[model samples]
Target: MSYKEFLVQLSEASGVSGYEGEVSDVIKKAFKEIGHEVTSDNLGNLICFKKGKNPKGRKIMLAAHMDEVGLMVKDIDANGFIKFTTIGGVDQRTLLCQEVIVHGKEKVYGIIGVKPPHLTTPEERSKPLEIDNLLIDTGYDFEEINKLVEIGDVVTIKRQVYNLQNNHIAGKALDDRVGVAILYYSLQELNKLQHDVDVYFVATVQEEVGTRGATTSAFKIQPDIGIAIDVGFGKTPELNQFDTIEMGKGPAFTVGPNIHPGVFNHLKTTAKDHYIPYQVEVAANHSGTDAWPMQVSCSGVATGVISIPLRYMHTSVETVNLSDVEKSGKVLAHFIASLNDENMEELLCY
Candidate 1:
């Protein structure tokens, strides 16, 4: 399948924090088709370990979160309307009037309902709806709703993949879904090259809630180098030029205290030497990606980050450029291939 088609299938699948079975199934199937065996940790983190030629060589890790910001059923009212709570860092403002899929006993389709403008006071209309006031209308009565949905079932906004001009596409859950896509592309690229380091590509769970998956997985793998693939803010009129990256350029290589200087320099030089396009994103402290926890895991690890420029993050209409994803994966494969015993020692020295 094409990368975009796989990405859309991933985005449309429901996988909230602590509940990544559906997403795991899709990714595992893809990995298995490529002759890689998939394993899961106690925390639901999916791990695929590819052994390298050198047994004593350095262990490398690539991480991307699989969970996306969404909602969960908090309660079911007497009238059958579903009251829900936020999962991860959901924007309450965007939950109104959107179609949603509730993963319960069965897939339940519903729409978030809001007060009509005719009934609302002008002052109320001036403000966005709050989570407390939002209700999901499933068009099913209490008994039917209970039979299908239960409290704590996850709800994801339904968005069709809309292809835009150039290679950009719009949909929900692209924040780190694109990051997961990088793992797929990287695996394909790695198969063509000879690398000495055993690479572990992880599809982590519950990252939207916290970097829970990265923390535990890093401790388990304890790789010499960890690279987190994620999304960064894309260019928009309201955002500052210095704070956002332009779409269709390439992935962003981050530089900051949290990032290992040696790894960062290698990634930059690899991109340049190989003529792979890339942008730079500066982080003051925590990059808010899987790299955050991986850096401090198991006596501390050297961590790096690569982000695809993303528009409207954490919303249903999240946008990304497929070219950027392609470049990011290529750069990563090259960086991994460039790692050797001598350079790995130097990189870990400081």
Candidate 2:
């Protein structure tokens, strides 16, 4: 599938944290077409294995999460307004005035509503609005809404993924969905190359909630090397120097507690050898991605992270560059193909 098609389909799918069945189905079908043996872990991670010339040479696991930050209904007010609690971290300022999908008996449209400025006292308008004061208006009475909607249904922002100027793409859920697309394309590219190591392409679930899927799958796969593909913050007008990376430039190679130095260096060297553009990301604490779990699984796996430069992360209009996405896929495919039993041994020695 084309990158544009992949982005649209992933962005449109509602797979909030702990509810990733729909997104998993899409990923499963894509991997099946590439002739990989697909299976699911106990925590709902979709693991696809492609056997190499030497099945026992080494194991490499590439993971990308399939969950997005959204909301779950908590209560339906007497006036039919819906109250909710976030499934993952959500900025309250962005939630106001945004459109949303209320996943009720069937999908229903709703708008996040708040007291109008005219009604609010000047003192109230000056302070930041609290989440409890906000409500979702679905244009239905309390009895009617209760009949179609339940307390635990998911609620995602209603937005269409779009292509912006300068090869940038914008939409919701690009945080890890873009990672999912990159992994899928990389598998397709890897199929054309002759490699000596077995590779597992995993579509992990509940990463936003706490990397739950990766933790379980890593213990099961016990790979020699693990790489988590996810989205990183892009340069924005409001962010400071340390907070943003340039867009359309290249993918970011993470350096952090979650990454093994040997694996990171190998990836960087491979990128340099292939003349692929790449950026460096430094994280002092936990990297907050699937790599966090994969690095410490069992006896500990050598882990690394690659990220697509994304703007407006965790918002309705996240943005990414198409060229950056393609280059990330190619770089990963090349890195995997460059691995061999001897080289993998050298990685272990470090």
Off by over 4 Å in 2: none
Ten residues in sequence with the least summed lDDT for candidate 1: 1-10
Model 2 scores worst on lDDT over the 10 consecutive residues at: 1-10
> Which digits, one per residue and each the tens of the lDDT, describe model 1 over residues 202-302?
99999998899999999999999999999999999999999999999988999999999999999999999999988899998999999999999978899
Give TM-scores for every candidate, taking all chains together and pairing residue i with residue i: 0.98, 0.97
Off by over 4 Å in 1: none
Evaluate model 1: give its TM-score: 0.98
> For every model in order, what is the number of clashing pairs?
0, 0
- Return the top candidate by TM-score: 1
